[model samples]
Each structure stands twice: as structure tokens, then as C-alpha cells.
Target: MIGIDLGTTYSAVGVVESGFPILLANEEGRRVIPSAVWFGDGAVEVGEKALRRRGVSPVVTSVKRLMGRRPGEVDDFPLPLDEGDRVRVLGRTPEEVSAEILKELKRIAEWRLETEVRKAVITVPAYFNDAQRSATKRAGELAGLEVARIVNEPTAAALAYGLDKLGEKARVAVYDLGGGTFDLSVLEMRDGVFQVLATRGDTRLGGDDLDAALAGWCAEKAGAGAVDGRMIKEAERVKRALSADGEAVFRVPFVDGGESIEVAATRRDFEHLAAPFIERTIDCCRRAMHDAELSPADLDAVVLVGGSTRIPAVREAVSAFFDREPDLSQHPDEAIALGAAIQAGVLTGAVRKVVLLDVTPLSLGIETFGGLMNVLIPRNTTIPAKAGEMFTNAVAGQRSMSLRVLQGEREMARDNWRLGEFEVAFEPAEKGRARVGVQFRIDENGILEVLARDTATNRDTVLEIRDAAVDVDDEKVETMVSESVEHAFDDMAERVFTEARLKAEELLPAVEAVLSQGDGIVPEEEVAGIREAEATVREALDSGDANRLKAAVESLDKATEAVAARMVERAMEEALERRMGG
Candidate 1:
């Protein structure tokens, strides 16, 4: 048996070897394959080869986002859809295209194992509905592999993280922000069993949004036409570069009319462009925790999974939201594939320890300040859902917050019907200092109850919201309840080499320019400091630690700032004087 993570942007395969599960690399020694397919000149190419042919040939990418979704269901797609919501591309449906990718993965696994793989387990987003799940299985079958089971992405990640620590009892939330989709799953692990309590996600959101943000910025800066696939690919490259170093350059030469587009981007610039998407993920995290009847304090850990989590900004945001540092032990890209392989091992008697997974349905949340629906429970989630969140005082001296229980599809709190409204109070304190842990529990009887605990005074408030009577506006209700890469190329040392070198390129030029003219303008003490900083940077540049070089470059940039400022002032004065003399 083989396990496959059939991802949106990339796909990976794994299998048990010598009683341990490990990912199987491709012919090029890559653990993951780009989820791209190209067809041209009566030939079909998949993975890296196909990805490279993006602008040159008819290639389809990011098809996973359209999987199992109807044409009307999804707002838009790059490809056209048939009457059945099947993606119509070159007379092939999305499933068929997906099957092609699957076939390639099977090839890799079979080649690596030197055995014919007949049965395999596949993974999908935790929030995927029955239709999406079924569609995924169909694609697997089309690839000529027996679809053993469809595992949830987040569940697989949790399995990989907790399989070794199953003797302990703890609740964890797997925050999976992959290349093209996001899934937030709350799970409880105890007694060698992994149980998913609640799961929520947005099928349309993920790292792709981040890339698009940067790509759009690139296009705008280039004054180019529409955002093209080439620009997007370059953006992905620059995004990866920005992940480790301070900045990277996106250069596209010989463009339309013999021009070029070159833009320099810092990590902060990318973060600013990607902030809204990150905030949306944060919103889902809050909602999923509430649905699982968990406060930030309840979770033993928030395991960061998926390639997007590699971004420093993303890690910081998750840390801020959970009030704790995210668990970074798992390799962001390999954990899911490993978990899938573990599942395969379980089926083949190579491994033990069972995993029980669950999901949520329509989102259930409440209205907080700004009339936004803070989801307590996401839709398509399994029944008997319970979750919680920690609310803080928005301002100092605030006595209470009006808790409006809301249910529906809209993001705005006012658009959803209110089951009830009440006040939850805590001791007055400085802003964000007063904390209230609010938990929601839905019993098997379908009763919804909410509990608010004031941490400062240890006071408890309970509200049985089910008895409050849901607003009977069928129209409003109908409008509600809605739908829910680190390149393996080069080792770490080689990967950071270019970015660190680029940082050096940017720093040394300005440093040299300033020192050449700063003899009289800059103080001798600061010049010595600048020289020392530059020497340290050069020493680090000679060493193998790219990260150390980045830090040293930053220090040198700081040390030379005053001198550079003086040079700039003198040059401006010289230019003004020259203009007056002329």
C-alpha cells in the first residue's frame, strides 16, 4: 500500500519501508512533484517538467481548487466548466487531469519500492464535503490505484505529529495552510488514538493568495499588462527567497518591447501585501477553536503544517492568535505525506495505532465588535461540536461585552440570525489584560450551551443558547450556513546562499559609496564602527552560515546608516550648489 498527499500545488507519495514510513522521492530525487500538467504536440508531461512548460504550452495548474466544485458553486476559475460542473480543458475533465498527476505519483512510488502498488490511501482537505471526497477518490481510481481511504489533510498531519506521543492526553489544533487551501482541525489525542473534534477551512484560501499578492505587485510595478503565469511563477520564486533572507530581487528581462521588470522586495513588503489573507486564516482559527470547545489555553499545541507555515510572518501571526509559540517540530512539507504513509502501514499491518477523524458543516459563530461573525463552529463539522475562545477587553475600564450569538454564511455578524444576545462581564483592567474564556458546547441532543469564565476572578457564566429560539427568517437562514513550497531543490546551505549573497550585494555597494565620501562628514568613531561591522559581515560571508551572514549584513547596514545619511546630505548640497553655479 502507498500513501499519497494529492495536494493542490504539489503532490507527494510515501510508503512503509523496514517498518518505518518514509517519503519516496522522484526520479530527480525530489520528495514532492509539482501538481502541474502540460499537454502539447501529442505529449503529456506532469510535475516539474510540466511546470516548466507553463507559459510555453497548454498547462493546467491549481486544478485541485476546482475539484468537486460546480461551475456555479465556485465564483471563478481560469478554465471553463461544462454543464456538470466538470472543468472543460482540452476535452478532459478535472478528474482526468488529476488522474494524470496521480499516475505520475504512482509511477514514482512503484519505482522506488520496486513493487506494483495496487492499493493506496489519499488525502484531501479536512473541510472537504462528501462530493469533494468522492471526487478525489474517483480521481485516484482513475489512476489505476484502489482508493483505500480518503484521509483529511490536517488529520494526517496530526497523525504524523502525535503518533509518537500517543501515550499522553492532550488536545491540539493542526493549522494547515497549504499552497492552495487552508484547513484548521482541532483534535484530541489519548491512549494511542487520534480523534478530530472539529475541522474548518476555506477551500479558496492559502499560499497561492500570498503569491498572487506579490505577483500583482510585480505586475503593477512593471507597468505590465494583465498578471500572467510567468509573473506568478516569478513571484513564487521571490516569495521563497523572502522567506529566509531580508530581501530578494524579481527580475524579468527582455519583456514586451525589449523592456525589463525588476523589483526588490523585503519580507516586510510581502507581509504587508499578504496581511489580509493571513487575517482570514486567523479568523478561521478562532472559529475552529470555538467549535471544538477550546480556548487558546486549552490546546496543548498548535502544530504548524503546510509549506505556507514556513513564512516567518505566518508563524508570528499564528503565535499571536494562540497566545503561544506554534509547535514547529514537524517538517512543514513532509508531515502529511508521512501520516498518509503511516495510514497505509496500518492497513498493511506494518504499523499500529488507529486514527479517528471528524469534520464540521456550516459555520457557527457569534458577533463581536465591528459586527463581524467570529465563528465558534464551522459548517460541515461533525455533530456534538464544542469549542471556545478568549476575548479581551477592547479598551481599558470596559465593563462588559455584548455577546450576540449568530449563525449563517455571511462574514458580517449582523447578516446572520441571532439566537440570543447577552452580556459577559469581567473585572476592569487595562486593554487586553482582562481575559474571558468563552466555550460553546453542543450536546448529542443538539442543545447548544455557552460558558464564559473570567480568569481574573474565577467567575463562571453559562447560557443555554438553544432555548433562545432561532430567528425564523427562512430567507436569512437560507442565505446563512455556507460553505467552508519549500523547494526540495538544493540543501539548506545552498538554498540560502543566493539570498544572503544578494543581501551582501546590496549592503557593500552602499557602504562603499558612503565611506568614499564620508571622511570629513562622518565621525571617526562611527567610521571605525562601520568598518568593524563590514569586516564581520565579510567574515560571515566567507563562512557557511547564510543566516549569520544575513544578520551581519543587517548590523553593517545599521552601523553605516549615519555615515550614509551624511553622504546623501552632502551630495544633495553639492547638486544644489552646482545648479546655482550653472
Candidate 2:
């Protein structure tokens, strides 16, 4: 069994051998494989190669953010393809894209071990909801591996940190800030058992946002028309340079209309641009500490995980906040994978000396009357737990009752994350006469399953909730309760139009900037076609037609597909030449 850290920016695979966990490098002898995928004409590329061709093809990066969200629920990202009610690329869902990455990792592990790899343990953010966890398991299955376990990232980090210090008792905080997710978990180690006290994080916040922050600053400094992929890459380089040096010089030649820019940015300047994001992480740390009911002084050690921790500002801030220097013994990039591998070992009986006990990050509940929340499993409860509630019809001749499952600590049902909803049918009888029992079970993987039993007949039936609709006002609830068959589609057109408008607002500037630089590079006819498509997009935007705007966006993407590919190729060549010359 291998342990896989399926991170947002990069992924790594590790294995336990001779009672110790070791990271397994990929075919290129690189331990960290960039979590990027590109859909080419005849082939699909992943890792570094896909990252290099990011702006050329339909590249999917930071897909972990989209794992559990419905296609319509997410509108911030640029996903041009659609498959029925879900987003797709080259006719592949997010799970399929993730499967490709996992498949590659599996291939590398198989090649290195010279054995058939069938089972593996994967790590995800502690705060990931049921939908996300289930989606991750599905991805692993699609990759031809049995997902032996789904471990929390911070819990895994704690395992990696506590493996060697089993004889010591300590309270440790694991700060994990990856490319697209942030999680702060507090754990206590005693004897040979590691117990997680609390975990908190934002799945959407991470280093990618830091890159965007710097890129925005760079765009403003360079007077660039927009923050494109190339600009983001350059900003990332400057960010790394500033980490080692006090200052770094940034230059971009012929950015627009034969104009070049050269600027020098100091560490202070970069920190200023990144302060908000850093502060956000610090806030999460404080909240986690509070949830764990401990002070900074109570922590025996603070362990940092993920590539973002390499930033000096981040490290300094964490040290100052925790009032002590963080333990740097474990490699930030490989610790989670190593810990996962150790957990896998425990499952396979390869490592029996250590035990891991993790907790749910949020409370699980169902909507009660008057828009109130009735929690079944409170937060921080031990995993693989089960809870059940009995319900009766509110009115006579009421055949069924709907339970809107929720996950969060909020008191109001609407404020919590809606896991899904299911209905239990009861025997026809007078008011409160029919009985039904609903069970909510969180398996070892932290995935939820709902089962309904007819108390009258003593029969059980499984219920599947596809779309987890948010809880609304009492009147809306009454309507749903009375209908018991179908829920109304409310404000769908307005939501779609708003989503389309947002996409157009983001894409227009990039299109304009690309066209601004395409005068000499792109063919005249192609440029003309792109300009026409752009006009159509503008018209759709003005007309407030979501479908029209979507069509126009697709047309524009098709028109400039070849040009974008060429531009990316040229940029790559120039970058390679610069490196070789240096």
C-alpha cells in the first residue's frame, strides 16, 4: 500500500518500508509532480509538461476546488467545457481529470516497486465535506486503485511528526497551506496514539491566491493590460527570488505595443502585497487553537506543512504568532505523503507500533422546524460513528417527510453547508401516527450515507440525495414539505445569467490583451475572426443574455485556440533560451 498526498498544486506518493515511510519519486526522479493536466489533440499530458503548456491547451489546474461543487454552484473559475449538468474538459469530469493524475502516480509506484499496486491511502483537507470525500474516493477508483483510506492532511502531518517521538507526550499544531487549500489542525500525542483535537481551514484559500496577489501588483507596476498566465508565472518567480534576496528585478519585454517594463521589488513590497493572505492563515491558526481550547504556549511544537511554508514571511509570522519557532525536521512537501504512507502501513499491518485517531471537522445535522438546525453528530466526534433520529408526519395522511441534511456548526440550517436531502415514506395514518427512523453514518473515510427504515414494516431502504438544496424560509420549507415529490427551480435563470456575466467580465480583458499582442504574431484572418467573436461577446454582455454570452465565449475560445497555443509555445521557447543563456 502506498500513501498519496493529492495536493492542490503538486502531488507526491510515498510508501512504508522496514517500518519507515519514504517518498517515491516519479519517472523523472522528481518527488513533487505538479498537479496540472493538459488535453492535447492526440495525447493527454500531466505534471511539469502540462504546466509548461498551461496557456496553450485546455489545462486544468487547482481542480481540487471543484471536486464537490455542482457545475452551476461554481462561477469564479474559467472552465469552458460543459457536460450536461457538470463541467468537463475534453469530455472528462473533474474526477476523471484527477484520475489521470492518480493513474500516473500509480504507474510510477508500480514501476519503482516492481509489483502490482492495488490499494493506496489518499489525504485530503480535514474540512472537506461528504461530497468532496466521496468524489475523491471515486477518483481513486477510476484510477484503478482501491482507496484504502481518506486521511486528513493535518492529521497525516501529525502522524509524520509524531512517528519518531512516540515515547514523548506533546501537543502539536500542524499548519498546512498548499496551493489551493489551507488547514490548521491541533493534535495531542500520548504513548503511541495521535488524537486530533480540532481542524479548521478554507478549501479555497492558498498559495495560488498569493500568486494572484503578486501578479496583480506586477500588472499594475508593469502597466500590463491584464493578469494572464505568463504574468502570474513571472510574479511567482519574483516571489521566490524575494524569499532569498532582499530585492528582485522584474522585467517584461514588448508586453504591449512594443513597450517594455523593468522594475525592482523588495521583500517588504512583496510582503505588503501578500499580507492579507498571510493574515488569513494566521486567523485560521488562531481559530483552530481556540477550537482546541488551548493557547499558543500550550503547544509543545508547531509543525509546518506544504510549499507555502517555505516563504520567510510566512515562517516568521507563524513563529511570532505561536511564540516559538516551528519544527522543521520533516520536509514540508513530503511530510503529508509520508504520513499517509505510514497510515497505509498501519492498515496493512506493516506499521503496528503507532495508532491514529482523527475527528470530524464539522457538525452533521438535519434541518428542524422553523429553519433551526438539529445536530446529530457534533464536531470533533470520533470517526466511523453513527447516529439516528426518529420522525413522524406532522399532519394526518402525510405520506412522507423530507430531511435536509446539513454540515457545519451554525445554528440556522441555512447557514450550514447542505450535504443533501432525502425523504422517508410513512404508512398512511393520522397525525404523528406513522413512524420512520433516519440514520446518518459517517464511515471511516468520513463519507456520509443515509438510510431510512419504516418502523411499521421494519424494512430499510437507502436514499440518495443528488442536489443538496440550501434551506430557505419557512414558507419555502412548507411548500417542499407539502409537495414531497419535486422542489421548485427558483431564480435559476437569474443565477445563470449572473454567472455568465461574471465570466464575461473576467474573459473580456484577457481577450483584449491577447489581441493587443497578436498584431504581428497571429494571421490577419484569424485576428479578424477573434475580433468578430469578441464583438459578439460584447453584444451578449450588453443584451444580458446568458446563453448568448456562453455561445459567444465558446466561439471566441475556438477562434483563438491556435493563436493561444502558438503564444504559449513561443513563451516556452523564450524561457528555455533565457535559462540556457544564463
Candidate 2: regions farther than 4 A off = 78-84, 256-258, 465-582
Ten contiguous residues minimizing lDDT sum, candidate 1:
478-487
- Output the TM-score of candidate 2: 0.78
Q: Report the lDDT tens digits of candidate 2 across residue range 1-582.
A: 999999988999999999889989977889989888887777888899898886566678788877766655555554455747765656778889999899989998999999999999999998776767878998999999999999999999899989988999999999998888888999999988898888878777788888888877877877778766666667778888988999998776677556766778899998998788888789778877877999999999999998888899999999999999998887889999999999999999988878888888777888765566678998888888899998777668988778888865555566566767667766789977888788889888888888878899887877564532332321122122223222223233434555666566767787788878745767887878888988998899889775777788888878878987888998999999999999
TM-score of each: 0.63, 0.78
| Each prediction's number of clashing residue pairs | 23, 0
User: Residue 477, candidate 1: how far off, in angstroms?
Assistant: 14
